[model samples]
Target: MATTAISADTSARPAAWPRALLLIGRVALGLVFVVAAYTKLHFNGAWHFSDYYFFFGMAINSYNMVPFWAVELMGRVLPWFEVALGLALISGIALRWVGIVASVLLLAFIGGMARAYVLGLEIVCGCFGNSEKLGPLTLARDGSLLVLALAVTVGAFLIKKRAERVRAVLAARQETVSS
Candidate 1:
């Protein structure tokens, strides 16, 4: 029995540059989180007792959205969370999910900055270290990060779809050969 041919241009490989770029984006985002976490958790990068908890608490308080009770808690928890997420991204364990999380985190930062800007609050972002004030630059930086993570997520999704297409082509060919 002769089977119909499966034509999908499978001979043409998908461009690898997009996948490489996705890896680059993931690593870059991971590095950002790692550096931020390190700066927040350590004082002056000397591994000494850092004032991050106290200073970060003050920073969060400046945002005015967090209640007094949660301000300190958030300040205390955020750094560790950053570290974990950074490690995960760097490890490339779950690129899609991590990219999504990174994007969400950036969005949160952007929202926070927007809130401060609208409220005319002249507070430091305290992301890496103590900054002069939270202004347009801070928002722009976070917005850039959001864009990066979004690109990573989209790239990963496309790669996945491409892989599925290849598998489908292979399965179809196998069925034809057997028939």
Candidate 2:
């Protein structure tokens, strides 16, 4: 029996560019996190430490959104998380989970910037590092990151879904022939 031809365009050829773009996005986000953590822990000194400490404290003790202990734990752990996620993205392992975690972090950053903007607080986003100023423009700058994180998330999802579909199709064909 003659089998129907599978179109060349239909097969998921391993494209270098998509992987490259995803890697870029992952590294960018990861670098941002690692740098932000480093700056807060080092360069900006007391003020940066104070800012992060208070910010996290509020999230835990005051806001009651994320637990106080959890926020405290993140204060020490976030930078490492960034480093790990960045490495995972660049290494091309578990891309989907990395994308999801990055997305969540970006969303949180956006929310913080938006809150500061609305509250009329003259604060630096402390995104890349501590700065003297922040405003709607800064928030917009962070929004771009949210967009990038989203793109990465979607790309990872698509790749995984396509792989799943291909595997399912192959398995079905095998079953049919065996019976």
Candidate 3:
């Protein structure tokens, strides 16, 4: 058996345009999550930290709908989850899974915010701390983040689908030639 030289073109490039866009979205989402988490972690004072925590408590309790401990846990871990998701997005490892998870998380946040808004709760949103306010404007901002997360999911899946198609075509050609 003789070995044949493979052309350089046979090697895959680092990333194409679609992958680049996906990467950018992932990084941007990750940064936002990280920043939000950072703001919460470093927040101080009676209103900034305490008011946000109290509002979250209200949401989890559903205005006295659920348990108090559950509300506390929800308030405590929410920021950490965002931070973790952001790190995963930035790492680009298991991006497909991460993007999907991030999208779901965003949807959950949107729903919570919407519910609180409908209940006529005066909240800070705490998404970006006291800097940002709640209401239609905040909902729009949350929706925008969700949109980005969904785009990241779609883009990542598209890349994977393209890779699978290319692999299938190459395999089929190889089979036909071998036969």
Candidate 4:
């Protein structure tokens, strides 16, 4: 039951409106990132705060994938990265590249989860500062977000191609009229 706030005029626009679709995709993905970051940054009240970064480190360490030396660094940086991605996606600047990066990150998360599952390590998701044990549901959620990111990429390309065709057609018409 997800409701998109995209404008209703999308259908009325020209066929080369992949940009419109891309915008919708960006906002959707951006929201997920924002919420994830908020959970870490605002977990405890304004005055009292949870050590989300440290907890996240513990959660990630439970997976036993990342090297010991890198765990702390990653835990500290990941939340900030998610916030950046959220802002970038919502801004619609470099939409295609942002979508690509989001997809790649989602893949990495999914990979980590998959490995943990194989090893019987029921680690917390740590995605939204949640301590719930990981399982198939996490995989499905990440997979769905991946699909949205890819859709934005494909849509943007379609818009670019259509714009090119339109430009070519207009140039041809101008040439014929001048002659």
Cα-based lDDT for every prediction: 0.81, 0.66, 0.76, 0.76
Q: Best candidate per TM-score, number?
A: 1
TM-score, structure 4 vs. true: 0.81
**Maximum-lDDT candidate:** 1
**Candidates' RMSD to native:** 2.4, 4.6, 5.6, 8.3
Evaluated against the true structure, the overall lDDT of model 1 is: 0.81
Tally clashes: model 4. Answer: 0
TM-score, per-candidate, Cα-based: 0.89, 0.70, 0.77, 0.81
lDDT of 1 by residue, 1-179 (tens): 12333553566667888778878988898999999888777765455344567877887788889788899898888888999999988888877888789888888888888988999988888787666478888788888888988898888788888889888887887887788
Question: Which candidate, 1 or 3, would have the higher TM-score against the true structure?
Answer: 1
Of the candidates numbered 3 and 4, which has the greater TM-score value?
4
Candidate 1's TM-score: 0.89
Q: Compared with the true structure, what per-residue lDDT tens digits does model 4 show for residues 68-174?
A: 77898887788889899999989877777887898899989889888888888867877777656688988788889889888876776677676676666566556
lDDT digits (tens) for residues 44-105 of candidate 3: 54335444565555445543434778788877778778889899999987989999999998
- Clash pairs, candidate 1, are none
- For model 2, residues 15-116, the per-residue Cα lDDT tens digits are 678767877887776676666566555653554544565553333333234666777886656655666776776666787887888888878867766766
**For candidate 1, which ten residues in a row score worst on lDDT?**
1-10
The worst-scoring run of ten residues by lDDT in candidate 4 lies at 1-10
